[model samples]
Target chain A: MLNIKNLHVKLEDEDKQILKGVDLTVPAGEVHAIMGPNGSGKSTLSYVLSGRDGYEVTEGEASLYDHDLLDMEPEERAAAGLFLAFQYPVEIPGVGNLTFLRTAVNAQRKARGEEELSSGEFLKLVREKAKTLQIDAEMLKRPVNVGFSGGEKKRNEILQMAMLEPKMCILDETDSGLDVDAMRLVAEGVNALRSPERSFLVITHYQRLLDHIKPDVVHIMSNGRIIKTGGPELALEVEKNGYGDLLAEVG
Target chain B: MADTAVLAAQTVAAKARPAGTALAARLAELDLPTGGFTRAARADAAARLEAMGLPGARDEYWRYTDPAPFNAPTADALAYTDRESTLFGGIDRLKLVFVDGRFDASASDALEGEGLEITTLAAADAAGDHWAADLYGKLEASGQKPVKRPFAVLNTLAAVDGVLIRVTGKVSRPVHVMYRRVALDADVTVHHVVRLEEGSELTLLETGGIGARSNVAMEVELGREARFHHIASKRADDAKVGIGHVFARVGEGALFKSFTLSVNGSMMRNEGVIEIVGDDAVAHIAAAVLGDGGEGRFHHDDTVFITHAAERCESRQVYKKVLKNGAHGIFQGKILVKPGAQKTDGYQISQGLLLDEGSQFLAKPELEIYADDVKCSHGSTTGALDETAMFYLRSRGVPKEQAVVLLVLSFLADALDEIEDDRLRGDILTRLDEWLTSRASA
Candidate 1:
């Protein structure tokens, strides 16, 4: 479960307040999509939730499974089962992808009082998980995100999500760089990981991604707050007409 | 480019300090070992060294690292118990052990092997006709014209007997030279000569340092079509001061590659001069250095000069240094393309990683091209760890220090990747990792 009560955030290097009094809640085993136009703080929400630097929370109370997310360090939040699929995956030269994956998997496990997996077991698990994402062995051997195509980077992000198996997954602009086929593959990967104990908060601009991975609830975010909460059909209405009508109506 | 004038002025202003007096006293107290030809060579070098004097603060070449520690009358050698017995203990090879700069016959293997002629400098001194007769102290004298390395000449003049190696055929196993110090306040000098005949190959591996203040001079000659690989690890206790010099001559179509890896020392310098004399020859000199961020004042310097004399020759120089805490690192490398050396290919890169704000790195990269048709490039960079990359790794659940280790290893990979031998590379990498782990714990 994830909870947020009037989350406010601002750019640390500038005097600009990006998020102002946003309230949202997603219960267990549910998928919520926040659809917003450009400059509506969609990306800032994900970055703040993932504990990125240069962003100060002016006032907010956010929690994941009764653990105060704001008080924990980034790695601690990750160990608490909070995962953020970055909009742009960082390219880490000289660090093999497999090594990155293993270190992350083991680090989270170790922080959570779980025994680390052996190299053999980890390799076997990764291969099996990667098989469904269509990521070949060579892709796993190269450095992280170095020279990977856009689609390949998205798939690798999904592969990482599958490996970490976090309880709360936040997908930020995942569909922005993906083509139709790539979007389908990413959606399939996300859909396969959905379970009773896991939840997702998908943030996107268009309904194209929603058509593949259906969300149980849709929230219309404007400026910095949620203006409306509706069912799946609200997406189609905005898809046919644009957010122009919705913004006028909310005003 | 000369520092003698500056040193002379300083001596005048300072009212005749011990700089000259101490050097004269030290040289007068010691006598060159008895060897007819090598003694003659030592006499020539001794006079040259006396003229050059010991390096001082005014010396251009010793600008970043002070030479005061090396000028001591005697160095206090630290007793060592190698955390690991030998550097390349996993592989079977010819292992030569030295204690306090003297060859340890009881701990060394036999002096002969198939396709290899190995003898001590003491034995070679008594013999009139030997393989190293022409090589002994020859390269040192030749390397002195462009640069004045008085310490190298000092090493040649006052050496305590080293090994002479002659390779006539392929040598599959590496010859590892192990140096360990057991006495305190011990100063030792050694000179080694290695000759690889035409079409022959040899790999030399060295680890550890000799006295508290030690000077080691190594000369290598690769004949036509021959290949020589040299890898040395300079490791000293927290209090030791050591310097190593390597002079190599590459013949026609010959290949010479040398790499030095350094882990901490109070004061340390590794200088190399590589000459490509014959056409189509290739020589590469690289080094990877690490110094701790501690109170011991870790200072490291790597000075390299690579000359391309013949047509179509290739030369490469790569130096990587990592300084943490209050450590200081210096790199000075130059690639020279002679007038007639057309179509020469030269590449030089020097990089430094400073772990903290207090650490410092000084790099000087040079390229001299007299030929019209040549391709030469040089670059130098000094930077801290990438905070974004660090965050990415930490966001993925890796801890902070481990992330640093990853990035540091990546920074050094460009230089470490130059090693062609897989097993040796792996061993050196392990040593690097060990250095990282130890520093982290400290």
Candidate 2:
């Protein structure tokens, strides 16, 4: 469902390349976990795929279901079934969470030539989804991510991903700064949304999250390029051996 | 035949009087005592206004707001007439009506609440009970030229009959004063004095009615431990114009709050002067001006004086304006502290949101202090709605107009939240929504 061939991304107006000639692909019905140390360009790849501002694709062709992903706007990419769970979500004051979610869902729906959801229908769906994520109905009425705890913010991101039901989901450090219980809840939420046609790219620094949402393939990234690819056992190897050996091997 | 001649002569005499002379004549007829005071005080106040004159476009304080209309030669002289009654949309509260420069007893309702005394300054002056007189015209000579606004001068020179409200100790019920302007093409001016005694609490809601043109000035005195909540809403006819000034003195351990909402007017100016004179006193002044079309050419000037005469006084001023069409809005606020006024806290903020390209706004917030142990801060912001926020909402399937309305309403909700009265807040919000809806349709 997703493919990246020798992806080369660089910071705008700079000589340094963050993602240098990296290759990866995730087929339908698979979850791929990418683990690496700091400065491994994990976030840059997500940003480049999500079409965020100020990230230039120096030389790469990223395709999501045969459509060029880098050419679309952020909202267009979102409508094209691309969802990025931000590590630090932006706090939008005075914008209700339900309102934001409804907007996102409707945008994608409208782009797909589907009927827009009325307020009543939207509220009903939101309530049902919120219940599943342990998010109270009252929290949906508050400003998006405003005054939300660290755990609640992560859960809220997951809730949005579930509502949109995107085909390609990128979780950027979803387990960072989360407690054990919150991590379990997040993993459960993500697991419930898995399907045969859907794919996910889970980015993390620790292998603990992989225990709940086990990935089909584990890849170690060092200095932008994928160094090694293996099965779930690769995560345990990184957890015990650290990235020092992986960096030496990649170089 | 003799009666006809006498009537004709009276008419000729009234016509021959100079512009604003009728108001001056009426002032002379009211047998009210000049509150016994030093001549120097009154002279000083008169000198300051004379020096300042009517603020024109050249004055920095009145640059964006022009007060020249009040001084125009085409303005009609003040005259009383028996006109149809004005309605306040069925508010069942105390009402005080003023026509031209005098009180209209036939238009006023009776006050029946305990711990409340509502009467004319003329009657109080006749009985030698001069509480209102002593407090009246005192702010003019307070040596603060900034507070000596041109409208206050006009009210001082032409005021005839004024309303005096006295809330006795520990009263809870509110006093509602309705200032109705009925004269068209004529200059009508009024002066009002309100006193809240020690340990008393009162809410005063003043509404300005439709008229040709009017000028009003009021002085409020709060006693020790007293609390005053004032709400003023003014809606004028499209052709009508007005200038209003309110001066308040808050005593030690007292709390004073004023909320002004100006929705409709061709040209209007609301000047507020609040003084915290005693220790532990609090003064909160907030205003919202919503203007649309070419009619809403409104300006507000809020001047706050925190003397810190005792210690630990607090003062706050907040002003928000929403401008549409070719309408213009202005907000000028100042916070002042005297020497040795320790532990004083003063905050002032003025913000405006322009809805259209033709709409304009000017905000100026200033702070002047002599004490070092005081906390004083002032900030002002004027800008259009965020285009990014608008597009974000639009991309979500919300209509463009509805998105703009929601953003504008949210911008104003912060100010409206400060209003403690739910009914009043609801009324204002409804009016605002209606105005925004109509504008969208137009």
Specify the highest-DockQ model's number.
1
* Candidate 1 C-alpha lDDT tens digits along B1-442: 1333223333332433455565665565454565644756665665666677778888889888888887766665566554534567898789888887889989999887777999888777765567687888789989987888978987877786899999999998889888777776568788899999999999998886566677889999999999999988876462278888899999999999998888857888888899999999999888888888584778888999989899998888888898888888998998888899998999999998999899999998888889999999999999999877777777778777777887888788877877889999889888887778667645
lDDT of 2 by residue, B126-208 (tens): 45445565676686445245444665754554454577888886655556666555555545556678898998887777765
Model 2 chain A worst lDDT window (10 residues): A87-96
Clashing pairs in 2: none
* Candidate 1 lDDT over residue span A88-199, tens digit each: 8888876789988999999999999999999999999999999999999999999899999999999999999999999999998899888999999999999999998999
Q: Second chain only: TM-score per model?
A: 0.93, 0.81
For each candidate, what's the DockQ? 0.66, 0.14
**lDDT agreement with native, every candidate:** 0.84, 0.72
lDDT of 2 by residue, A1-251 (tens): 88999999988877778999889999988999999989989988988887765667889789889779888766777777888888877666656688678867886788778998999998888888888899998889888788998899999988898888888999999998899999999999999999998999999999999999999999898889999999999999999999888788776
